[model samples]
Structure formats: C-alpha cells, structure tokens
Target chain A: MPKIVDHEERRKIIAKATWNVIAREGLGGASVRSIAKEANLSLGAVRHYFQTQEELLEFAMQLVQEQVTERIMEHIQSHLPPKDQVLNILMELIPPEEKKIEMQVWLEYISYKIRKKELQKESVHEVIVEILHRLQKAGLLKEDILLEEEIVLLHALIDGIALHILMGLVPIERGRIRYLLEKELNRIFVE
Target chain B: MPKIVDHEERRKIIAKATWNVIAREGLGGASVRSIAKEANLSLGAVRHYFQTQEELLEFAMQLVQEQVTERIMEHIQSHLPPKDQVLNILMELIPPEEKKIEMQVWLEYISYKIRKKELQKESVHEVIVEILHRLQKAGLLKEDILLEEEIVLLHALIDGIALHILMGLVPIERGRIRYLLEKELNRIFVE
Candidate 1:
C-alpha cells in the first residue's frame, strides 16, 4: 500500500522548510532542490505540492504573514488595557530573540519583491492603521494627535527598530524596544 | 597604444557599476562576470581593480556609506538652525526620489552582511548617536528626555521609515518624511 500524506500539512511543512532555506541562504539560495533537501522530501514530491518556485515562495511569504497576524490577534483579544494592547501588538511585529528567523525570512522576501516590482501590500502597515483607528474610536488617543501622521510615524518607527535589531547594527535590546514604545504610547494615549 | 586608466577613478566606476547591478538584481545577481559586462570591461580588467567579487562588494558598500556620509556632513555644516540641521541630516539617511537606487543598494548590502554574519559597524547608527549627543551638549534637547532611549527610538524610527519607503509599502512622500522627523525633533529639542 502507498503511504498517505495530509495535503495541507505537507504544504505547511514545505513552506516552513522554504523559510529555513530563505533564512539561511537568502532568497537567492532557496532553490527548489535546496528546499526539497531541507524538507527531506523528494523533488517530485515537493513539486507535487507547489508547481513552481514562485508558487512555493509566495506560499511561504503568506505563511509568515499569517503567523504574525495570528499572534497579534491573540494580543488584541487579551484583557490588557488599550494602550498596553497597542504596545503589545506593535511588539509582535518586531521580532524577539526567538522570532529572529521569521523576521529574516520576511526581510529577504520583501527585498526580493521590491526588486521584482511586485508591489505587494504590507499587512503590517494596514494593521497599525486599523489599531490606531480603533483606539481613536474608543477615545483612547489624545485629541491633539493627528491620526494620519501617527499612523505613518508609528509604522515607520516599528519597522526601523525591527530592521536595526535584525542587523544587530545597534544595541537595541528588548528592554529598550519596550521602553521606547511605552514612551511613545504615553505621549499619544490619553492619561 | 594601450589605454591608460586612472586607477582610483576606474575602481570607483566599477563600484558604481556594481551598485547598478545590486539595485537591478539582488546582491546574488552581482557576480563579477555580470559586473564586468555591466561595466563594459573584460573580466581580467575588472579583476585588476579588485581581486575578487567579495572585495568588489565591500568596496561598493563603502562607496555607498561614503556618499551618504558626505551628504550628511554637508547638512551638518550648513547654517540652518540646530533643529533644521538635525532634520536635514536625518533626511539624508532616508533616500529621496533621486537617491532611491543608492538606498536600495545599501539595504541589500546590509541584508547580505547580516546573512553572512559579517556584523559590520553601521556608520549611520553611529552618526545618529553622535548627532543626538551633540544636540544634548549644545543644550538643545529637552532636559527630561533620556538620551540613550531617544537614540535607540530615533534610530529605529528613521530606519523603519526608510525601509517602508524603499519597499513602497506606504505612500510616504518626501514632505511626510520631513514632517514626521521635524515633529520628533520638536518634541526632543527645546524651543
């Protein structure tokens, strides 16, 4: 009898293997052969799941986005105060020590997309805008804060800090990330 | 008669060609063979300036850093007010329309270095830290502001914004970048 495999499960596993390959060698090195080797699956088996390298990469990128969104959604549903909720949600976007690989993979995907002129929409920016809008609706934001500017500024701030952390260019530790974010929240949130 | 090339000038030209290759294709596409083709020189001619592709990439990266630094230094020496000067300096780090190619090349170089575990010192971060310190020393910064935290925050914010701009994720125009940076400066600098 032939062995049976769960189609969706296998795709997830292959997507993750793709992430590993991307994180290790960048998008350039994430060949179908390498991904198959990393996933411990035969080339034919890998091809059965995703027809092309672009298809596999696109699926992997979506998985990364979904994972981040799922985590952020958990933070949003928690019993934390509005300010804390927003801060926590922002923190989810910037990778911690353990989440570094995901961030690296995402960064590589982003650079590749930009060069290819794909111009995909970034969900993180949309999430930030939505969160800020929700806060404003709840009367949590200071009246003086310009919602549009804050959205742009906060989005840029988070991504910039995340990039710095990934590059290890500066000594921005978790403590500093939290402290700086809290300060910004304190400035914009109603006391 | 054999052609006479100014050694340093030829090297700089080759480095610029490398930047063009990196910007058009990711760093992975920046092989010496392609670079030689891009520079309209023979492979041996290209090797005469740099022994290897690694050497060429490092030189190209250094040129990007120098170009950015030179622009920032010009802003620093300007007669603009301290706040305006700081804003201008920050603006130089985030590429405008004309400087997009340079910024793209820098981003790729940074990502490539991180993957290689090279951990090169980022001059932009150092420059930011130094600028903030100068402001504090000049008594331009608010007394209550924590210099260290501000340094980390500002650095992350600028980089995040730059990344977003480079990726075209958000519609952050030059005016918006200026507006946001000025706002941050306004909060930190004493009127």
Candidate 2:
C-alpha cells in the first residue's frame, strides 16, 4: 500500500514551506520545486494539490490573512476592552519576536500583488475598518477624528510600522511595537 | 548627416523614460528595450548612455535623491522660517503637480532595495532628521514628543503616505497631501 499522506497536514506543511521560501528569497524566488524542496516533498506531490504557481501564491497570501485574522479573533473572543482589542489587532500585524518570518512572508506577498498588478485585495482594509467601527460603537474613537480618516490613518500606521520593522530601518524592540500601537490608538481614541 | 545628441540632454531623456516605465510597468518590467521604446530611442542609443540595467536604475535612484536635494536646497537658501523650511523639505518627497513620476519611481527604487536585500539607503532618513532638528532648534517640536521617536515616526508617515498614494490605497489629492503634511508637521512642531 502506498504511504498514507494527511492532506490537510500536508497543505499546512507546504504553506509553511512557502512562507520560509518567501521570507528567505522573496516572492520571485519561490517556485513549486523550491517549495517542495523546502518541505522535503516531491514536486509532483506539491503540484498535486495546487495546479499552478499563482494558485500556490494565492494560498500563501490567504494564509497570511487567515493567520492574522485568527489571532485577532482570539483577542476579540477574550472580550478585552475596546481599546485593548483594537490595539491588539493592529499590533498583531507587527509580528512577535518569534514570528518575524510571518511578517517577512506577508510583505513578500504584498509586494507580489504590486508586481502582478492585482491590487483588488481589500480584505485587510475591510477588517481594519470593521475593528475601528467597533471601537466607534464602543465610544472609543475621539469625537474630533473623522471615522473614515481615522480608519485610513490606522491602516497606514500599522502598515508603516510593519514595513519599517521588516526592513530593519528601526531597531525598535519587540514590545515597543505594541506600545507604539497603544500610544497611536490612544491619541485617536477618547481618553 | 548623422544626428547630434546632446549627451546631458540625452541622459535626462533616458532618465525620464526610466521613470515612466517604472511607474507604468513597475521595476521588473522596466527593461532596456522597454525604456528605449518608451523614450522613442533605438536600443543601441539607450545602451550607449547606460551600460547596464543596474547602472540605469542606479542613475534613476540617484536622480531622485538629487532632485529632492536641489528642491530642498532652494528652500534652505530662501531663509524662510525654520518650521516653514522644514515643511518644505518634508513636502518635497510627496512631489508636486508635475513630478508625480519621480515619487512613483522613488517608491519603486525603495521597493527594489528591500527585495534585493540592499536596504542601506539612509539619505531619506537623514534628510528627515535634519529638518526635524531644525524645528527643535527653532523651539517647534511638541514638548512631549521624544525626539528620536519623532524622527522615525515622521519618516514612516511620509513613506506610508507616498506608498498609499502611489498604490491608490488612498485617493489623497495632491493639495491634500500638502495639507496633511502641514497638519502632521504642526502636530509635531510647536502650537
């Protein structure tokens, strides 16, 4: 009998391998063969699940969004205070100490979107606006801050911090990202 | 009779072509042939000016820095109020009504640096710090904002706005960018 392969587990392994490849060599350097090699699997096995490189890349990008959403959902379900939950969601984008690879891989995917000229992915924008709206409902947003502008500013702030940290332009410590997120949110929200 | 090409004028033409190509097709698509076509020049004519793609790209990036420097120097020579001069320098990076191509190309170059793992560009950071220090000397920076953190934050804010504007993540109008820059400067500077 042929060895049994856990399909779901295999997809997880491939997704992780894709992240490693992107983090190390960038999106351009990733290929089915490279991902397979990174995952220690045969190319055929990797391709059996994903028909094309674009498909695999889409999967990887979705995984990045999913991971971020899952983490944020965990915080939301914990019923943290509105400000704390909002800050937690924003801070999650700035990967933790051990999760730098995820941020690198996410950036690679973001770059890929530009390279491919596929800028239609608005899920992140929607998720951010949703959280900000929740904060507004909770009376956390400052009355003077326009809701739409605040949402855009929050998204831009989070993206800027994530990019700068990934590029190593700033030598900020891990927890400092959270602190900055808290500080910026505090500046925008009701005292 | 053979055509006479002014070498300096020819370089300027090629640089503009390079910017157009990058803004339209991104860096990966900006090959010599494409740039030559965009410039309405023979490939040989373009190659005579720049020996390699890397050289052309380097020239394009250096031109970005030089243009910003020239504009800022003009302001520095104006002997305006320090806060006004600082805002002028910061706003230069955002481009005017005419030089939007330059900002797009600059962002492309910045992205190239990250993808190539050559993230050693520090001129932009230095320029921001230099201006902010001028503000601080003029007794302009907000009393509570940490100087070092302010530098990094300003850098991130400017970069994030440029990236967003270029990527169409925000439909921020050109004048509105100046307004936003001024508002951000006011927030950082004295009341």
Per-residue accuracy of model 2 over B28-97 as CA lDDT, tens digit each? 5678899889999999988886766567778777777787899889989998887677777777776654
Which portions of model 1 show Cα errors greater than 4 Å?
A170-172
Off by over 4 Å in 2: A49-53, A115-117, B1-3, B49-53, B96-101, B142-144, B172-177
TM-score of chain B of each: 0.92, 0.83
Worst 10 residues of 2 chain B by lDDT: B163-172
Report the first chain's TM-score for all candidates: 0.92, 0.89
The ten-residue window of minimal lDDT in model 1 chain B covers B48-57
- Give the clashing residue pairs of candidate 1, or none: A160-B160
lDDT of 1 by residue, A1-191 (tens): 98898887888898889888887787777788999999999999888766665676787888888899899989978998788888888989888878887788878877878888886687788899899999899998899988877887888888888888888764657777787788888888888
Query: Mind giving the per-residue lDDT tens digits that candidate 2 earns over A47-131?
Result: 9867676687777877777888899789888877777777777777767657767766665555556545677755566788788
lDDT of 1: 0.82
lDDT of 1 by residue, B48-76 (tens): 76776567668788888888888888997
Could you say which candidate leads in DockQ?
1
Q: How much lDDT does each candidate structure score?
A: 0.82, 0.73
Q: Residue A25 CA error for candidate 1 (Å)? A: 1.2
